[model samples]
Target: MSGLSVLSGGFIAGLFAAVTAAWVAVGRTVGRRPRPTTAAVFLMAILLTIAAAADVVNAYFSYLPRLGDVVGAATEGGSDPHLKTADLRLSTTSATLRAHPRGAVLALPVPDRGSGFGATTALVYLPPQYFDRPQWKFPVLYLIHGSPGIPADWLRGGQAADAGARVAATGHPVIIVMPRMSHGWLDDPECVDGVGERVETHLLRDVIPTAESTLRVDSGWTNRGIAGMSAGGYCALNLGLRNRSVFGSIIDMSGLTRPTHAGGLGPLFGAGPQAQAAMIANSPDLYIGGLGPGPRPRIWLDVGRHDRTVAVAIYHMRDFLDANGYPVQLHVRSGVHTFTVWRPALREALSWFADDVARVSAA
Candidate 1:
């Protein structure tokens, strides 16, 4: 656990106890008629406790993949990924490094000259089949994580390893590529190219190419899917919808309709027409509204009913997708914006995407 996680847990424990104590304290004081102060204190305590607990939980364990898969270190990669080190750069002159079976995750340090965002290490998940059947190519899924998070977030609590194992057990395998999004947890690029960061270029030009070239994975849209959470969900929709020719399906979860940060859009994208243009270009709502005659890629949208921040926005997106030519599967789960909801939904999504991939292959 990070220091933040410990600090967060301590904070939440104090908060939870304080609120519960307050409610008890108030309840004891209240008589036949409820006092306004008592009522206010009770409501405040309940709401604050819920909000604080959710934040603490997400912060503490956001590093686990939904499935508990093992990760390994390699010597050829130069330094250790455990120490946030680099790997051998992919060179045409060098031999192709095959996926290993000892571990499901291979951390490779990838560079992005186009983005100018500095080099980032991606956590790539290889199924058992990847090693057993070296001759068979597999599908690819570009799974992204929430902003204010790192690439390791997907591995630690996303439950992807469990879902991948389930899929592989069915005689199907997919390469799951999780790239580090922000330079740091606080750096929100909105997954767009701008004055400082050309993040989209990093993913499309550098990350995708690196994964495809390094692994025996399919290179077509029919075999590819994109999904993310929160800000990452926004990127999945932005990248997947705009590049329908590249992604066959997308799972958007608890994503905002527009880009926002701890500061707000004004500071993140700069305040003006350029920001407006960026939002319009990146908004899936905008894309769905102007969708053309041809069928677009499959879209799945899910949000916890109790997702205070994005429940309404998700509903609006669901309506937009339905009313317009493009239709999405809207799943309103029974929880807030936590992995408690996402892990199960992710299982369904992988199954759904695999079905799509299977159908395309059969056709």
Candidate 2:
């Protein structure tokens, strides 16, 4: 049932049938007087209809591909609070690569001492070439999910593992790792080191170091890239620009100009003069021009042509980066700020980023 597509004709038809049956049961209650049981049945039918409609909307957005994904998100957090390396080993056997050509997704606990945000697990996507080539060091691409999201969002909604595998087939394979961004559902840290949340330190200090030590990936900045969608996109841009020595490239898909939250920045930075300064430090637009002389990282700003609000806002950013002599690409495609647009973008970006990594490695 988990593999069943909610958009499939059979699945939609069954949902419609169930909803119709529920209404029919409610209709039968209408002529039986105003009994309490009749009212209860009518209420239940209304709830069923609403829930069915909600599921349809959810399917359209591709947020939850499988029924099991809902349960997985709720139980994604771990009990371990200590930062440690995952006990994993690389398999170079040809039989293992033949058995699973696309590669596999590993769920590992990535507790970090930097931020102590240890209640989550990171998802790693190892391409088939990882097992086929024993001595080759693959480029690492860190993919971040949107707000109110978990690491599995990239797998279930964005189809990130499938996208990475497709790029791998082109002989430019990359190790794509999705790490937990926020402390909780609806908690939007915007990947900044503000107040009590040191999200930036978590990714830079803990996640990257542990992955490099444990995995057979290139350790140089030129062999590393970062990409994200929505809130995660903002993070990719902010973190990549702020730490150019850490990431060689950045792919921002439908991101904002600065750190944002539905509740505003008050909760994130707190109330103080230092808080205001931190907010200024985190905003990419404010500091993009101040970046000193160095080899600037290549950046790709992707937004939907139909998404006018974000597309227009990021134009000045593209201009600023261009004016500063940084290599930047602005990609405008059809669709909005959802997975419908990001899924294909991730595939193309993985290929492009991996190719650049290969070129630099060859150089």
Q: Highest TM-score, which number? A: 2
Q: Model 2 Cα displacement at 74 (Å)?
A: 11
**lDDT minimum window of 10 residues, candidate 2:** 76-85
Where in model 1 is the C-alpha error above 4 Å?
1-4, 7-103, 291-295
lDDT of 1 by residue, 257-326 (tens): 7666566666556668987887677777776677576647888998888986788988888788777756
TM-score of each: 0.75, 0.82
Stretches off by above 4 angstroms in model 2 are 1-45, 62-67, 73-99
The per-residue C-alpha lDDT of model 1 at residue 85 equals 22
Cand. 1 Cα-lDDT: 0.71
In order, what lDDT does every prediction score?
Answer: 0.71, 0.75
Q: Residue by residue across 130-167, what tens digits does model 2's lDDT show?
A: 77787878889999878766676777668777777788
